[model samples]
Target: MKVYGVVAAFWLSLASATILQNGQVRPNDYPSTAISAISSYNSSWHTYSPGSPELSYKGRWDHKYISWWSAPGLKFGFQADQVAISFGKYTSDGVLVAYRLGGQDWMLTNVTANSTHLFVTPSTTGYNLTTPTNVTQTLELRVTNWAYGVQIQCVHISGGAAKLVKIPDYTRTMELIGDSLSAGQYATLEGISSYSWGLLYGLGNVEFSITAYPGICLHEGRCYSNLHGQTAQWLKIPDTSGRALDIYGSDLADIPNWDFAAHPAADITVINIGTNDNNTANNVTATGYYNSYIQLINEIHTRWPQSQIIVISLWSGFSQVGNTWQQGAGFLDEIQNVVKYFNNGSLNGRGECSSCFVYYFNTTGILEHSDIGPLYHPTDVGHVKLASHLMQYIKLTFGWILEQTGPEVQHDTLYWNDEADY
Candidate 1:
């Protein structure tokens, strides 16, 4: 597939127009002689660009890098025992990435500009991944934190691109839009702890893209940085760009306009925002929330008009005082109006509302009173609960059934341990 080149903006719209029929896992592509070498013993290395269709992007492609913690990064199969990749040519130093063969514990690597790294071999120190009997092995790469982004310049396979294999059987694409809760703030491997990741990891077949940023309000204002925040209606690049420039010292610019058509239009798009807007600090009026949300939904519909939109009311770790947990700010009530206004025709005095295929799920009391964590976000355990609840809702609402059970043991626990310092 000609995955790159923005010259023809036509394909961009088409990608967003393509939606998966139903949620389904990719069929496993195990050859009859699974363990047999697919190439001659004399292996020659070959390089392929990030847009090479040979790569299986389990994560969202910003058209340059696999971003956000929802699906974290990319994964692909290689016939060689070893591989090398330039994860970042434009990214600055000190960006950490974790990668491992399927069924292996994550191994960490730090990146600098245009750095090339080889897969850790079995005999190498600190290498704990299993050496499968099969020659073709799949490598899963993910960013270690949300404060930064990882870009793949090119990948070098030992044999050739001909040996590259798809991850197989993935049926649907979902774009997750939210604030810190979806960003996995305060949890280990932040994005991985989000409800979006929870749903994707639990369901197993859906490809997910996260549009979450910590501290962002749906109505927009100062959030993660002093510059601007990603609002429900005006988001193109995620708000993480602020963190990228401030904290990581990366040479990057906020993408002027995110290419909506870079990936297939989402089959399902979930919106979990409003915490920052209705909080006592922001106290953004209901009128502002209603108009902003109406515009956001209308914009999403225009891009992926056929996709289903799921809007979830906000949740939080309420502040505790005098042995009493304060009730939440009632953001869900306001969010419900956002949903109601869409289906009932735009009631917002703002111009208009596009026709929306939307559903509003009340997540007011999703977490146990005990599941809230610091920063008023869900704890690792609470994320599990939120993901589970949403998955059930999707299954019943869309008639989506799973072909396999997940998340494997690796996915269940934190990718980081106390011994390792990120």
Candidate 2:
């Protein structure tokens, strides 16, 4: 196992004005009504810079163009019959971006390299962005899917190009930490983005910061000789090497530290790791994993005392062993054991200790055979299934369910890739 001791410097963008204030959306983030929306339409494309306060940002850094790991997104209001977007693509055609405008149903489309993708909000029962329908329309977009590298420029409003007034409304936030199962694979159709999207639509008012990559582990040391542990990656931005580095940077030395104080502490943090630790050739022991995870838990506690940390086991259990119980040959038991240690062997530990910060949910049989993708990870179908169950769990345990249940997935573009092993 290789040890990494180098601490990367922090990179805080001066241009990220759309930043979260005190880890929460600034009240009435939208611009004052003193500056009215453009009542008339424009024949030319009206452009705005990404740093414009009119644009609200979350789960991302401020840059000339925005791109990073997990689901970096925006929420803003505008007046336009059509919207055109341009983005920078490093390797693959930046695709699988999810969007909703004019309160319409969610739509999925690919933002091809060096090209402008035009989006026309369809006429739903309540929404129609056209001249007669409404004076202003709000747009919510998230690059739930990552395609190697992406740099999103500004949006161009064709007709009613009003100043983008970003409005963020959320009661709490969630931080999802994991590896390939959490981060989509190379050119994967949709990462666990659907899961986050499901939570967004179902819960109605919450935010998610996805701190995950293709091949990471919870314990230190290494996995695939590249992925560093969560302790290292959590504080840095993701690079192109299936790792986290500065978005413009190319190597580990250029990795930039993420500012936790600038962002909000997670009300709920879901940790799904350990698969790589067990699968790696390093032959990590459960004791080693136990210690490392304890470290992770300790850090989380120190950062957010009132946070609920849910540790989940790997979905893909190893090959059937002994015929007694069909599951993986990895650290599923040990992972749960660590949770039990904190819970004092009591399944309902919260009742015993009001301050108990840890909880465990065994996902041994979460995914069905068909839902499992080729890489031994959950496919789009599998992700939705997983999200549904997670939502159900949160509702039952903490009574946090809202009106909506799940996102309306785009059937045509529904194959997302994930997971990896030698």
Candidate 3:
């Protein structure tokens, strides 16, 4: 896996306050005031005040690709033409910003790391807003990039007068943990795992967190170093260094650990791992893998006592080590046995978690050789299929109300064609 470094750069200054599009320049203005990151409307993993407009930090390893902060049911008093956001970084693969205006569907746009200031208007470069103006409206924005950390300073509105209003309380909360698939490594255009799943589960009114990284494993160490050791232990930490601070290094202060109390405990925690552990290089035995996985689940239970642990079977095509798949069938069977053992109250190593369950998804149709590249990461279509299957399981298990007819379609014009396999 490639290590990411902090770039010392600044955003390009806007030549004009208003954006020019389709031969017309709209009037624009900076928000009269800003919302502090600590406000209830702004929900994130870490709270740090770097400067003005207190920032919310999202560590690189904690929720790289699919982590998001949203303000739902925000009522604007007057017509607002555009929204601007300020971030700490401005580079490539920076962040994907999606918003839902009023009662309409959600729309998506990309935010680069080169520019700390992001301006989104009806006549924005990539997407156009369809919600009617000059009326009370609600907006929600989600971050989609997973490579580096981001600190969202504040959200700004322009064009007309408006004020930030209270958002309704969410009924349920969720947390997702895994490796590259969950971190959205290859599927750059429209495949942040949590985004796809959020749409599938109709999670507009739910608060959620995604904790994952590329090439991380359950039993084996991280993709980069063997010293990292086990996904469970790493989950407790804050950031994983791509450079000086690693498992082998003696740098302790460089890497910081996370505080579990920063965010509220989730109602449901879905874990999708073991793909890297099943790799031929890891050489993990069935017994070792099972024991390590059970230990990880127990740790999760202990951390979030009220959460319902749902272990997802690894998707197919990830076990290809040589001419044939390495741990495709056998590893799945082992995982099933582990789940059964936990459910039957046989392996209660860490206190019994009665709500623990297993979800075995059929990945035959979703993970096709053509869909995934040589590295075995899922494409946008593959992610959508995975989300569909997981959505079915959530509906059957929790009986969540299906508000929409189908999954929300994302219209993204900025597609990444040359993403490197980590």
Clashes of each: 6, 5, 6
Q: How many backbone collisions does model 1 have?
A: 6
Score each candidate by Cα lDDT. Answer: 0.60, 0.58, 0.48
- What is the TM-score (0 to 1) of candidate 3? 0.64
Candidates 1 and 3 compared: the better one by TM-score is: 1
Cα lDDT, model 2, residue 103: 54
Model 2's number of clashes is 5
| Residue 79, model 3: Cα distance from true site in angstroms | 7.6
Q: Candidate 2 at 200: error in angstroms?
A: 5.1
- Point to the candidate with the largest TM-score: 2
Task: State in Å the error of residue 150, model 3.
Answer: 2.4
- Which lDDT tens digits does candidate 1 get at residues 1-422? 01112211321322231212123332322122111121342256567888877687655445556454333677887655456677565553555566767656555566556566766334433233434334556777776455566678887665322356666736787888876678765555566556677686567667767767665677756533313444532345434444344433432243435667766778988888776666545556888877778878888889898899888866545666787765454555567676667668443322124554788776656765577653355667788888888889888777788534532422435445677656
Clashing pairs in 2: 23-264, 238-244, 239-245, 317-328, 318-328
Q: What TM value does model 2 have?
A: 0.75
Off by over 4 Å in 3: 1-82, 89-118, 121-136, 188-204, 220-222, 225-234, 237-254, 318-327, 345-371, 404-422
Give all candidate RMSDs, comma-separated: 12.4, 11.0, 10.7
TM-scores of all models?
0.73, 0.75, 0.64
